[model samples]
Target: MKSILTMLGIAAALLAAWSARAAIYDAIQFGEPGSEKSHGLESDDSEVIRGGLDEPARILLPRAPASWQGGSVKFKLRVNPNRQNYVTLKLWGGDVNENLLILHADGRQVGYRSRGDIGLLDYGSPEPAVPGRFYYVTLPLPMSATYRRERVEFEIVSTGRIWEPGRTFEQYQKKMLTPSRGLYRFYVHDHSYFKPPAEDRQGARPEPVLPPQQPESFEALKERVNRELDRLLGPDGRFTNQMQLLMAAEAAGLEWSRACRNPEAVRRIVAGLDNCYLRWREDPSLASDDRSAVYPAWTGFGPAAEAVRLLHKDLGPYLDEELRGPDGQPVRRRKAWADMLEAGVRHLAASRSRHPKQSMIVDLNLYRNNRGLRLLDPSKGLPPEVVLGCLYESVGLEPWSGPLDGKGKPVLKSGGSDRLFTAKRLPKEFGYDGNDGELPALAAAIYQATRPEPGKPGDERILGVLREMIRARSFFRYPALNLAHNPVMRLETVIGWRDMQFPGDVTYVQRPESGASVLQAAAAVLEPYSTGIVQQMFGERQFFPSLDRQMEDREFRTTFGLLHVPEHYRLLTAQPASSSRLPMSEGQPDFVFSDEESGVLAVKYGSEILYASLYWRAPHAVNFLARIHHVTPVLERLATVRQEVEFQPSGRIFVRPGWTNSGVGAGGLNYPDNVRSIHAGETLPIARLPKTAGTGQENPLAGRGDFYKLLYGPYLFAMNASSREFTFTTPKNIVYKRLPDGGEIAGGTVLKVAPMSTVVLRRAR
Candidate 1:
């Protein structure tokens, strides 16, 4: 009996020892609402889950102490179901930057520096997720001299899947007992001698947020500028490089010239500018080379052009002696400016294609025809319009090779081959489309170079071409086949749909499937011309005011171009008379409104009218046009509006609002399909028509149906809203069809409409 009792005592003692060996240390419960602030864990852009119906809170582990190194380590964790979680463990040596080893929950490990020299022990198996369950993972602790000195950190991340109906209790837990939002709870079980502090066993406080700074006063601003200048120009200044010093000096000179003429500042600026020009000027001998000698083509030509123009205008009289000829003789100030301009032009011109038929500058040697690969076929040489525009702008129209017609207008030579010119004419190769802003940009450059005066010989012709290019390339008209030929056109369509169909949030459009291409298109257009044609066009008041709509859209690239480019604001100072006006008699009406209190402008062509209202106090204004007398009152009520006029063959005129809704819930990723109650007596016009006929069959408006379709034009065009719905009254006995979803409006005096949706009415046979 005594021996049996002693055996039982020994077995109990051995069991107690085994339990102590399995004890967990440094445990963290993630979902406590206060844990985020209580713990020093930092989050990047990802949202913390915090315990919820379907989510678990995420916790980033703090850096481990050096004492925790050199042993086998095990991590026990509990995670919510339906989520794929990843935990990355990084072991650092001395500095955080000096990483020793990186271990992923997937069993992948990478060693860095001296740690790489030693073979890593295999971490058993990859961590697996058992729905709503706990899992354990073991890894041999890195105990090398490099690792013992450095420490470890944990980054826990999770992605959730959509919850489906009828899930098991384990798959979808109805109740969570822990305060920690559904995030994982973790504990470290280390075999090493090191132990964490008792206070740290709970959690650490979150980083504090800083308060915002107040605006600076005028005196404070002046002092700040002075300090910055000193820092840049002082003996121990950061601007020690020659380029930096020169830029600083030129800036100082310009500022002084504007505010108060400081002689010392002016002298320093002129000296710096001269030094820069001498060092950076293109070698005259390299003019024949096709490769761009200027390291960054833009910085070279842009600054040079600005400097020459400024020196000639502001300091020509004061520094005439500084302007020297190639022969080392002092040249006249104006003559020197002209010579510099001529030299720059010559260098650009020298890079042009030597082909007898080509004359436009070929800036991009990799692509033929100056990036207008579709417009100019290498076998057919340069287009006549491009050649004419370049020559007329640079030298004169006399240099053009085309034969003069009856009106003395140069006739385009098609290289003996009859090539069709139509909106649908695109290259067979997918990427060879000519819809890039490059064509319009080149046209604008040529137009500006023409130095257009009211009635110059080639001025009207150049302006006409430019105007056509802008209109044809613009999103004003729908593409013939709905196929986007290029990036700009694609962006136009995306913006149009967002503006018209989905107005409130762009998330639906921004999805990878839909919004990605739109973003790419915006970036492509904005990047190439933000500093060139886009700026110049805006400065010259040549761009349409409707473009301001892009500012309201949340597209990053579009917003960046509009905000980053300085010339976008030039429209504010543009002369109102410069707005394009189209004659109303030709079925085209151009409306211009002039009021100091409200800046409003509208241009109408075919079925569409582009309009914009600019005023901070009353950013919305209604414009009454003489051409559309019937719809003037409706037009006046809307601030920014686009009116579309459709004529049915049945002599019915259908005028409808074309702009997208700017209200909340109209612009997000999710589609808002619920109908809202609209007040009675509101007048609205349906602009889009059905693609199918009354027979419930597809209506192809080509061949047999074309004539009938043309005959059923718009006649009577007034729509009124009922107490809780939209209504349209037919003045004539005509059949009306709704668009998108094909349905006929029963013949009646008043037609009811479904609110918050696009409706197009067509005259049905």
Candidate 2:
């Protein structure tokens, strides 16, 4: 037999041993990409992967640690063998010819497709009467030896058939015999787990001691990444979400190659990338324009061309470099790819869907997709300089999000507005229109690095705009992601998923592999794309409230947006130039970091954090939503509408009516109310907080953050975001030092807070 690792093209890792447990490991999960488990983890309880037997879905699974005992791989599949469709009798829509699905494990048949009927699907197994679903097609894998040797390939092949959603195996159980053909659909629940050897175990399991990560040489990392990229880009580029991954992988590699000045790596990236593009161009399923594929990404050529240009070299006149242009004549590879990308970006820049709250949903997505393209090569579509200039006029942050105006409307900032949006009154083909909602300051970070500096005499106007936007990020981005993420919001939205109760961890980990985090980490495939980063994102998904939250749950979900684009993961990595770094003062925030525009201030000094949302015009104190308004159905809002960790005027605490009140839940205890209410002018060191009965504040613990799930630093915040004045009384025993003008006060003192301004009181010695 071939070497197991060689066949799978994956290297195995050593892990610590432990006593047997039910789910010791789960290396691959259905439905979810980028959420694989090997040891110490398992896939969340999401629905299932609907890769029909025809288009078999493939996953580059993590190796099972040697310490793990042998276990059985259990699968719950929904099979439909018999189906009929009166809709279309043509070759593409006719009955399925697949009567049997032969599963191959370690290149050997696990199911008897050629022999006995017992191993055949539904041949002898008692299937449900109503084409429902059955649990457990248990395939046992006992770790015969401790060498970590195991089957590297496992496949269930039954793809070539009429896969219509309504049909089932039980409908024609008897006809699952030879030569039968019909429409059919099958589903494998994504939460499949590997059950350990015994239901009865001997003793308690030992604690796993994970080894410290050893850094690999660039050469070794490149080789490893190339192996995975080869599989993803080939055999055929028809696997689910392959286009986005293809684009991101190649673009990121090329970016890294350019940054490192390694033209050799650039060559390697383009070879596979070129082939993948051609394969898709030739594939009937994708090229015919039916567009039914689950993922909606197609811009695989943008980053490759940009890399070549940056490297200052011409892609040699190799005859093998094949690409057909719109005129049916051969053209430069850059021209062809650029042509298609321009079209896609054009449509995206003009998109106006708002019914399903597309603004909140697709806004970040559009920006994310644009990132992989990076908008660098101006050879095709809009001129690079022109595009940046227009984006300058179009993108804006207006109406400083602090207190309300005298007329009760939102106020404008002296510095600039708080939230960002595409500005009004532009000619066609300039400025996008989604809704009057959250735009991007990150765009400034993006353009700043990619474009030239603005302070020069000959510099274009766009550079000045980039400089302006970069500064604006300081004011708003702090509250943009976590403001509305409080206990009440968590119960209904983060946990309950804004009432979208998807099975298992579906809501939390929508597109595990696709997001800003994933894209940015593209260049880091050197260390990340394979290991800790992927799983860590999954772990953090349940709590984070940004685009990194993979919220694309359910089957037929189109990843054609953010998940489908290569992200911007190179934020903290090695810099290409001075522009690569944002100009914000990271080490200090004056004596007290304040932004009049956002009224969202912070003092992140050393390891300590002190944040305040002093004044917010909209009651947008806490929102699980990405935005407050929708464009199409004007004034339509999206929110988890829940109470917060508030400090009411009366100081009494509990669930505040109408998204009111403030409290904190950290380390699984409800301790936020300890701030209590002290009158505005009375500064107290120790606060007289309300008492928790009996067992004391039974609630989930989360360290640091307020109302928003994740813990951020603030000893005890003055938790009022309205235009009105409020006071914060510190808890007993803890004292705070007032900021800007330092003055120590006991924990029970009530610190007065002014509207539309920032205040900080540090924990005193």
Candidate 3:
């Protein structure tokens, strides 16, 4: 009877522990990549647990010594299956804070994550439905005393076709045995554990101090990097983003080999080169306005383009020394500029759909030589740059798909009038005759860099012209990217730009094995050919006030040219040849307001209306213009509204019927009172009120910005920037009773705030 029970337990352990790492039988040493020392700690009879038909219900993972710290528990799972089967795995941990336990099935199947604020083992997602092979799972168990007793559990279940009632034993054995090929490997290393004191279990001890590994000398580092690159990237020259970046690091290593003679020098050079190249290669320019595009140029410091020429020149010399050449010149081993660029283009082209917002083809031909709207109307066909430029422009901030105003001739503002269409005549019409000179310099620098000559002054010329030309652009007039295009590629060159705000954290990290993991750590990969950025950028659709609001605020009508015209303007990410500001008649304002005193008090912009009503405790404020005669559809006329209001005696005033009799003076009316009583009144009158609300004791008018729904959907929640955190609010029509707080208001048709940050009312399925 005791043997029967032991066998049953063993079978269960074998089934469940198929994918988990076997318990350590011998002491092992694992540390930094190259230097691992194994201390004699493993006992010959160390517990060996196998998962077969059934897995054990609990596991006590290895923990760091109470005094000696710095150890991690690494375990592997071995699953034997003939056909795909659904499965779920749970892990127990010491720390209350949720720790990530990685599960890899078929090298691609990733298990779901469970996170919490407290210490506990987490149950993960059900496994693959159709599993055909043995799978491996790796879990990291930190060596902390806080974790006393816990175990990992595996729940394997069927998902697809159910087994028939009758099946031969041999048939089932064949199905299961064919898939279970070999024993899975599990490794536990000391590197994963943080150091801790021997006795204390609750408190964390610092990790054992280890000296920083000094990098090899430039020559040695270069050789090692080359070897590593060869091991990772074979002859194909095609690699994942991770591989490509590591190759880039190798390129940096080569540069370091040439730039620095010492080991530390290589480190410094490579560190400085990391972020700039990867990001710049992704997006070359990030101009604020549509009138200019910037590209990092290697021209200025005493013929910098020569560096390219040098690479071309010495490349043959370097290769010839290592290998035989056909014509006595060195053989070219690395990919040339054209080949690499072509490969990049091909890769992006194949995956163009993945990056819809960015253009795969950077055809300067479509932009630089475009003569008329018919050829280059941004609204009609892709201008190439808009989709392409966003790949760079949206870094660290939200992506943008707005019009390509930054690439064309600067619409020099007159400053006299804000409306460019009216106050500023076309540059040609005004006979300015000055072409945007920045373009030629940019073009020249690119030319020189791509084709630098030995003993020629091309490099100096390119750098000088590009440096001066870029500095003259409008964005540079303000605090800007402080770009200094010098030939030297020296760090000092950027120090003087924009009060010396140098670029941030641009170092590259190279890991030989996993490409995606490393790239994910740095930044979300902006798929070069994907429209995802465009969709996210242009998705921020802004709705305007209803027609009634336009009728009320003459200034808005004139400023945006949305008055009587009844036209709606959708700001497209792609720039159109021309766009009208008129509001569409079909367009509806989100809200409508009216009062008994004033028939149609005023309409407000969506934001303006939301702002006025944010303090729900306060009455709504609706300020309106009285004189229809003063309103103008022309934007030029609207420009005078601000000035006229500033100089007027009362600025803007409202007179009521019982002004003198009811203690209501014949002056500006109560805007807030009008807004609140809008629905209460039977028939409201329309009157123009004073534009400037004086410093009176009662409700005064501040600009429209002061009032609005400061908390709106899609407004990112940040520790800073937002004071009122965004709590999911129930949608209208669908009834909701519960607030985010635990207390429930009602439940029959309640708003359920799902785990996903979206509002769900009773109507929501």
Candidate 4:
């Protein structure tokens, strides 16, 4: 009997140890390369000082302290008698810069503020104050804080300050505190009283939300895009006349690619090439009638300019100057004229491989990067042959042969200079009898120089070019891949979903099976990287940083899910693999499965996300994705559950006085299916809820006590989905609760949610 008791105690202790969980660290100050300044309201003031206009400040705050786990924290400026000057201060960030709450230092409550509220502080007059004065600034930890460290602003609103004749005040703190470490970031509160700060004053900031048009229906958005392209490209498509028509055709293909339109549009754009030939025939100035005669390729200057530079083996000069290679080398020039000629031959090879007819019109639009096709164009004056030579060296192609300069050696060009063109000089006084042999010979020379080394393997350039065309949008344009996509997304919506899964120990796996790509597609148009074509389009950022090690494992699995969080953390993908068991995939892994055994499941009730990952061997796994949206009720439910308990809304609900409760739950609804135990209370039918159920045993939560009963009280509504607005009454004891997709919900207010959407209902205060 003694031995058995000891064994039981050991077993209990082991179980408790096994149940312990750790929170993931949020890295806030990880300044993304170009992401630091997308929409302005600088992410941080780590570097900003007094008079630091146009200078960026970086602030990073540590991840939200563990204490903020289930609660929302509100941060605001607190004014003491000493620092109360007529200066303007602006605060941004919590929920996209909207002012959520305001409180006086002495506890004078101004109530919860909305976006329409004026919370900015402007100092019109300067006051004297001692240094190191402490100001009480409180960030209320409400029950719904998402990011660990959000950017805060404290701007000096008054341009000039007035001082009393008798005395002067210590100059205002020259610079606000910006984090140099940690992830939480804050920026100075400038531009609160007037125009936007300098950083945000540049080109039109892309909207946070994507115009509500689908990319599949490009018709509505394409015309506006084409017009913009036309404006950027002058009448003559090419920036110069040196490029051959075939090369010009290639350039045209690149232009079609930038728009990322349907293949049909790309084809139509390319077909217009024939029109260019006729125009060249009629316009003597555009393309000369005589072969080898000097003619301006300016007709190709419009959208195709980037392509024209490729013919000379150079891409865009400005872009080349901006983009840096991994080795920090400035890759911007062609070496020798021989190298340029070789590049021409390579182009010809790729062209012939695709069109068999030897049509010089290579549709690079279809090319993928892996094949070795260089779609990123360099600038002009560099010979294409030079770049070809570099490629030759990289792949061990063959021996090179081309004209040498004064020293009598093969021309070897380096990046950043127009060496190829500088080396060649046409005769000072040349005659154009329409048949100068020079130009075409140069073109032909380029073609001959690019022959593949004596039969090593298939042409990489050919394959690469073909694949690149098909994946134009993937290269340098995916919003998800770009760090800037974050701020761009934050501008429109308050929340986004980033799901991470690791099959191996480190690497994040984006299996073709998980279908997480759907979210990428959804965010494409909504993020800043998306071509701003639709009005309904907005931006929202999501980040999934998978540890690098476990990426390639075919037998990959992990136990990760979001649960117990306060706010509505959107779902990016299905749950990850169970903790104790490895996730398995049979058949096509990409298809969506209804089987809970396949992975985990997340149940969203109001703003709360309850997630669980199951395994045949392991007991269970749960995690909180964000702060619960409806906190009072959830806490109440949690309080009641002993080991497990059923979760449900409270009895008291609120909507507009006259709003009808008929047809309230019309869309796909997600709710708790089973409860192990129920706290006897007046259950109210707030509105019709779509059929919902739990995958676990019937009444999975039955042991819990009245901890779930605390949720019943007056409620507020947040209408999230649908646009329709109507009213209805609940059965005598029932009530209606509405949650708005945007804005705050008032107690007793039934927010109108359009048909086919979600609404938030919190127990009324």
Taken over the whole model, the C-alpha lDDT of each candidate is 0.27, 0.28, 0.21, 0.21
Clash number by candidate, in order: 39, 55, 82, 151
- Model 3 C-alpha lDDT versus the unseen true structure: 0.21
Stretches off by above 4 angstroms in model 4 are: 1-94, 98-215, 232-251, 254-306, 309-765
What's the distance in Å from true for residue 357, model 1?
Answer: 18
| Residue 333, candidate 1: C-alpha displacement in angstroms | 9.9
lDDT score of model 4?
0.21
Best by lDDT: 2
Q: Roughly what TM-score does model 2 have, to 2 decimal places? A: 0.33
RMSD of each: 26.1, 24.0, 30.6, 27.8
| Residue 705 Cα positional deviation in candidate 4, in Å, after optimal superposition | 49
Tens digit of per-residue lDDT, candidate 4, span 1-765 = 323332332333223212222111111111333433332323212233221122232332212332100111123332211110111212211111111112222122211111101121211111111011111111211111111223322221111121212122223111212122111222221111112233331222223332232232223223333443343243444322222233333323333323333333333333333233234434533321223322122112221322332232323232233222234554332222212222332332332111111111221111111011233332322244544443332211223223233222344442222211100111111100011101211222123223232112324552232222112212101111112222211010001011110000110111111201212221211222222211111122122221111123222111000100101113222222222110111111111111111112222233332222111101011110111111111111100000111123323222211111111122112112111111112111122222342221112111111111111123222211122443422223334433322233443343343442223343322
Q: Give the runs in model 3 whose Cα sits over 4 Å from its true position.
A: 1-207, 212-219, 225-388, 393-765
TM-score of each: 0.28, 0.33, 0.22, 0.19
- What does candidate 2's lDDT look like per residue over 1-765, in tens digits? 123321121111100101111222223333333332221122211123232333212221212342111111223222111110000000111112333333333333332221111122222211111111111222211111112432233333331122222234322222222222221222221111212224212121123233233332234323433444444444443333334333333334343322134444345445544443455455523322215333233222333333333332323443236556434677556544444444444444444132112322222233333433433343334334433332333343222232222222223343232223322211111011111121222232234334322212322343343333323332221111112221100101111111111111211111123323333322222222222322333232422333324433322222222322222333323333222211112333434544433323444444233333322111211211111110010111111111123322222222211110121122122112132211112111111222332111321111011221111112333433335665655555766677756688885777666653445665665
Assess the local accuracy of residue 457 in candidate 4 as a C-alpha lDDT between 0 and 100: 32
Off by over 4 Å in 2: 1-220, 229-339, 352-380, 383-386, 389-418, 421-755, 760-765
Which has the better lDDT: candidate 1, or candidate 3? Answer: 1
lDDT of 3 by residue, 359-414 (tens): 21122212211211112122332244442232222110112232233332112332
Model 1: residue 188 alpha-carbon error in angstroms: 52
- The residue-level lDDT of candidate 2 at 395 comes to 41
Model 2 score (lDDT): 0.28
